[model samples]
Target: MFRQMFEEKYMRFPGGRAKAATFSYDDGVKADKRLAEIFAKYGIKGTFNLNSLLFDCERWHGRMDEEQTFLTFYNRPHEIAMHGARHIFLNKVPLPEAMNEILQNRVYLENRFGRIVRGLAYAYNGYNAEVLAALPALGVAYGRTTEDTRTFALPEDFLRWNPTCHHTDPALFEIAEEFVKRDPAGEFKHREPLLFFVWGHSYEFDDADNWQVCEKLCARLAESEGIWYATCIEICDYVKAYRSLIFSADGERVYNPSAIPVWLELRGRIYELPPATTVQFAKEL
Candidate 1:
């Protein structure tokens, strides 16, 4: 009997690595300048969520001006995401108002940065059924919350993407230690990819006078083996591309329709499927 091992395939990050790390920080404040430098030093990437209406607005407090924004993020390997137009609690407002805030914020960012902004960080960690339902129509690919899951697991739903922990979590270092020490290939059921997502506001460091916390954390994770440090949108795009792979009838061959390449592990054999190419497998392992 010819057996089909369609269910035996597994997905990996860009370099065939099963572990990834991404960071998200909210509010465009001066502290982000230092944070950006720290991330650049470690070769890490993250997303900076900003309120479009707050930028260079005299009435707003602690918001970065256009010049400061350029100085902080221009040369950095980071992403810009919407955090509402005025940091409004989306769910508290009407659905149209929420969508308008998101759209205006996205438009302003796109105009300034010349890139389509697709990620969102809910202002005040607030959202409801209505706001969530309208995100896709407004062009948001994913939304982040303040909730912490405290584990290195990918989100089942990207819209409610809860991070592993905030940077200020008391066990931040311990959790980072766990992420670096765990081996995904050690067990069969745990063979899926793992992600360590950390989210917070850079201004929090100034309040606590603990910039060293992030400095040390970045040092701990910098250039670790088998770890793909990416921005939130990068991770989202990679996962989506991986999921879009198509399999042949017998599952011995696969096609990657997306423009991004994807890695797969089939019956313990690793394979890289380039963009728009089909790969046929050898005899059963």
Candidate 2:
């Protein structure tokens, strides 16, 4: 039974998908319309971080022309998260001001977007221990930073969620190629879940005049049978749900407490644990 359990213990994403890919774009801007269209065309999903205070201002850091366009562009199949109220550097600001920056933006986003704002990509990728310590009380489930790991792996700390790469990374295509070649069923196998998280500002594509970079990257990863394309919040929620699962003393049964369904692989077979339910596994020795 011990050996069987060891062999069966594997994590599978929704629909038995072997890998997950998510994108994060900071700063709501006019260029997001084109970027959104490209992502939608390729069936890719991502999270857009917006500064509520800068939504429609005519200033240098202004966002889209109108709030309605922003809403319509990312209403479904994507997420809208906070990027601070004024897009200030949290690490440099006083703790009270930093807290206000996050909470104010959260409230405005929740009211305007009509969804709970549970995630944030730090403005200017600025954060510190104090900021991390205060996030949970403000209802933030996860926070993304600009630090790139250049690898496909789940975050060790959601509060400081380091992304895999920036969209403009010179080796973007090479990384995508490496991600695509990781076949779960091949001899060279990885038992753990793989997550490819890319972050950047959509305006960069326009500034660089290299929209093809994103187009090609998306094309290389789009419609992959074994890959689950998700928004950043979706990825965080799914992983949280998976970790919330409770196991019986003998490992014969399990309970899921989260509202989201959890997937797991047992003895090379995938099992879905529906939300708020328990399931008994067949004994194997």
Candidate that scores best on TM-score: 1
TM-score of each candidate? Answer: 0.93, 0.92
What lDDT would candidate 1 get against the real structure? 0.86
Instruction: Tell me the deviation in Å of residue 176 in model 1.
Output: 0.5
Which residue pairs clash in candidate 1? none
User: Residue by residue across 143-230, what tens digits does model 1's lDDT show?
Assistant: 9999999988787788999999998899999999988887675556667788999999888898899999998888888846788989
The residue pairs in collision within model 2 are: none
lDDT of 2 at 113: 68
